[model samples]
Target: MTTQQDIPGRTVYIVSDGTGITAEALARSVLSQFNLTFSRIHIPFVDTLDKVRQAKDQIQAEREKTGQLPIVFSTLVIPELVTELRKADALHLDVIQTFVEPLRAELGISPKEEIGLSHQNMESLEYKKRIEAINFTLEHDDGQSNRNLEDADVILVGVSRSGKTPTSLYLAMQYGLKVANYPLIPEDFERGHMPKALQPYKNKLFGLTIQPERLAEVRNERRPNSRYAALDNCRYEISEAEGMMNLENIRYLSSTSKSIEEIATAILSNLRSY
Candidate 1:
């Protein structure tokens, strides 16, 4: 129960023997429960003694500067590297060994202390599926091409900048789901239907909408002082889009406050329920 008041100069160090993606993700998930802001430093590829020592030195420096122990989240696979990292004057969270040792004991087998194994299986069928899904999603993004619309696992419909593209890509990359997204413009609303390209894939459609104010802010960054970025227009488009989705019986979610991960997970859960 680390509180905001208890943490002075909150800094977090994510150290890993390979890419620090896992460590950083775990750290963020854990830190999210706390009410504190933290400056995150990622020290990746700490596979050797020298690299470990350097990471430790950085952690130590942060602790000295802040007068508070910097929280470290480490996924070092090698025992020696983990040992070295422990020398730093910081709270060390061994992200890997915590689960590894338990699993090793339960299975009664020695763990292969490998580095970057999680992402090294590029030749696996799952990896190939992810690659194909990514390519398919990219090709079908923003209603660009509908050559194989039936092949998509999900079709996203929303007003522009409602978080369609990134959500599509995340579904593809993370779950190997081939996703296609289309923007619901004024023409589609005037026509009183979804885009013709997406009509046949009605069951696959998932809609995303954003709050008018947020949509205006997002659009303004791209096209400042334009009617396209106006709050009134945003409200109109969102209203039309929601109406169309409801008319078509398509499921929809608001992306105004949800992260891309949360939106994708919700979409996947909806898809699974079908």
Candidate 2:
């Protein structure tokens, strides 16, 4: 029964032969399941023997300082480097080899054991599409412009602070979706319709709403005590926005309890359903 109280301040190291992004992401995802607080250290580009020795020294130092075995998540592709790293007195988890060895056995093939292949393809078509989608999403953010509204893969409509911008950007960057987002202002609600720019893209329209309380809290941080951040105003805007979406037969979801990844996945799922 390792409780949160048992580990006062554990050190977790992400060691990689490349940028260390993958190792860190994998480590964080696993660590989130535990309630204990951790001090994370990322040591990247351990491509040389000297760097590997340095990383091993750092891990050993942390273990000595904390009086606890440090946890190391490593994605080092070089065998010699991994062997050297293992000499450190820490719980070492090879992030890549764990899966790679099993897959190799099943497929009867050897791995290239290359470093940084995850992000090596810059001129790839998928990469170019993501870049273009990001540019399109930025250009069309918050009803700024509708120059190519019809080109958007999905157009998000919602009241302010309803998790539109981040979701849009994530959709674009991760899935190569051209996303356009527009705020549902009081004028649109009064006019009993969506924005003029969004009128033609009815098929691509998706809506996000949040609990009035949460919306107010998010807004209050940006503009304290203003009408825009008032709970009552949030309730009014959300009510009107939901009503308009219903009237227009547009699909909508609540962003109150969803992460950006979840929201984007849901949006993509709904889009694919059509």
Model 1 ranges with Cα > 4 A deviation = 1-7, 32-37, 57-68
Location of the lowest summed lDDT over 10 successive residues in candidate 1: 1-10
The residue-by-residue lDDT of candidate 1 on 79-123, one tens digit each, is 999999999988889999999999999999999987878884778
Q: How well does each candidate superpose onto the true structure, as a TM-score?
A: 0.86, 0.91
Q: Candidate 1 at 199: error in angstroms?
A: 2.3
lDDT of 2 by residue, 100-178 (tens): 9999999998998777778737789889999999999999999999798878999999998999999999999998999
TM-score of 2: 0.91
> Clashing residue pairs, candidate 1?
none
